[model samples]
Target: MIVAGSPAAWLDRAGYHRIDSPSFDLSMDSGFILDGEVYPGGDLTIREARALRFVVP
Candidate 1:
């Protein structure tokens, strides 16, 4: 399962120093396809800003 305050915070907290490319892969067998919601550990306003930067455009 993936959990973090935000995408950026997740990356920061997870120690992702650099993202060479703006893409990732998700295996089909991964669980929780539609079973849960992501909760940010910080303030709501800042969460989205931090998270969106990590998403590939």
Candidate 2:
């Protein structure tokens, strides 16, 4: 789960769960696949951004 947002965005440290995803290993820079969701703690400036940048690990 590669989340790219503003530097001010506070990432939820509560943690997340894992779900069954077939396309998991197909990615390069796959951070952590969360079966659940992440609630942003801070205000995200790029809330309306549609572009997603991923790192192929």
**TM-score per model over all chains:** 0.20, 0.16
How good is model 2 by TM-score? 0.16
- lDDT of each residue in 1-57, candidate 1, tens digit only: 233334566676777665344444443333232347644333222212235345576
Compose the digit string of candidate 2's lDDT tens values, residues 1-57. Answer: 324432332334534433444332232333443467644333222223457999999
Q: Who wins the TM-score comparison?
A: 1
The alpha-carbon root-mean-square deviation between model 1 and the true structure, to one decimal in Å, is 14.0
Scored by Cα lDDT, where does model 1 land? 0.43
Error of 2 at 6 (Å): 32
Which stretches in model 2 have alpha-carbon errors above 4 Å?
1-47
State the weakest 10-residue window (summed lDDT) of model 1: 40-49
